[model samples]
Target: MSTLEQTPIGAPGGAAPAGVIHDIGYQRYTGPRLSRRHVVGALYGHSLRTAFGLGRSAKAKIFPWFIVGVVVVVAAALVAIRAQIGQVVLGYAQFADTMSWLVIFFVAVVAPELVSRDLGSGVLPLYFSRPLRIADYPLAKFAALATAVFLLLGAPQVVMFLGGAFTTDAGWSGVWNEFTDLLPGLGYALLWAVVFGGIGLVVAAITGKRAFAAGGIVAVFLMTTPIVGVLSVLPSTTANQLAGLAAPSSLVQGTGIWLFRDALVTNQEGGMGIGDFGPVYALVTVGLIAGCTAVLLARYRKAARQ
Candidate 1:
């Protein structure tokens, strides 16, 4: 009041007066910054944990573990049958094909959890603000989802292998054969992981709403099946031969028939009619994985910019 009374300030047409400044004593962080690789590794680990709901709420744990339980229970029953009856109802390669629906459901449920929430909460910008490049985030998510799928499919195959090995009358020779078969089975599971993970992540990354993302993923897999049936019934032999390309499940089955005919097909009559276009199936399968991956990268690129 004394200063104001002593001098009148800011009359009309007068210039503005400067305000006082004060230092709050905040320190600058000059510490060593972690590189991009560390950021990516951490993100991958976090995403992988998210896939199985490791640190998530109990409600979040239910669906993934339910799918896992069903798959395991089925595998255990098959192992029991192999031990007791000495007859393999389904071979190693067939196990993946048999579990295709469950794999789809798992991907539908988990992929959205991995990505959509980040999108919904608008945390991607914060993620990009770190040492991570645009590509690192999407690739980390893709790798985590793929590893999770592999574990889901691979664990039960191990159980089946152990059951077969321990129960075989052929002794060590049987164990070796079981080992050999398990390798192809795991490889087939890897293929499943790639196809589903790539496709699912790309779809999930497109939207911020988890429900929409999940529905779109389900539709992507399920809606294509009828097209395959229609193509299979077509009059053209070429259409029938290439019909499996229409759906992801049939596409993987066709690829399996091409690569692991002995494990997937019991007879010429029982197998997919991929015909001489086996190479086509192989090429298309690779294309699906590669194409989905490219799209995933592009998706995040656009997201990062915005």
Candidate 2:
């Protein structure tokens, strides 16, 4: 019947009773805060895991691991064949050409999952609210993706090298020679990682929808190939050679040929004479990667400002 008792539920025209405050111990974080570098590193590691669908659901993992399994199996088969028949069935450098489509599919699937999910979920503000800078986000994401692509491309080559080493009847010298050959292919894979990863991230960042982003990335890569093909058949060899610049795959293959000093039969057989372009393709490849990276940075910068 006192004042406290008078504050009953649905007490008409009565002021609300004062709320009770419980003293549960809640401590402020006085621990050493991580710097921007650590934040970027953490993000990079996470994005790399995300690329292969690690730490994600089974459905998410199937695509990447499936591609990886296929590559491994093929590399193993090549090695077995070499051991049996005593000849190289697939060269380290040729692996890139053979697996180009799988690489494209991978970048398309992963790039969207990296950037578009962040944008679509409205998490950029949360990311920006941390010690992370605008540029750091893209840098980390690109690094993660590039690293992922490199592993995707490089792991098979390593397997191929080992396969070649053990299978070669020439012994230690053969192993050394195989190692030397892999070096250039490794370099070529690095180029693929950079160029493909950069462009995929840029395209994916443009759309919040993962499907749309994936589709756009695929379309851009696949569409350019046909255009290059058509142009390759032109009467003028110069025009045909120049057309290789239009497609990223051609450009990378062209650069690989120049760097490895080995003619890529795919480029030659496909009528896209990218090797003829020489260092021009390498220069263009670097330019394209640089340009895409610039655009990706600018896009994230704008998002951060907003």
lDDT of model 1, residue 111: 96
Global fold similarity of model 1 (TM-score) = 0.88
Model 1 lDDT per residue over 1-306, tens place: 122222236544554534434455667999998899999999999999998989989998999999889889989999998878889877777788788888998999999999888777767888998678888998999999999999899998998998899999998998999999998889889999999999999899986588988998999999999999999999999999999999998888888788887777663257469899889999999999989989998988888777
lDDT of 2 by residue, 65-140 (tens): 9989998898888888888888776677788788888999999999999999788776787898768888889999
Runs of candidate 1 with Cα error greater than 4 angstroms are: 1-33
Give the range where candidate 2 is weakest over 10 consecutive residues by summed lDDT. 1-10
Task: State the C-alpha lDDT per candidate.
Answer: 0.87, 0.84
How well does each candidate superpose onto the true structure, as a TM-score?
0.88, 0.90
Q: What is the lDDT of residue 256 in candidate 1?
A: 79
TM-score, candidate number 2: 0.90
Error of 2 at 145 (Å): 0.9
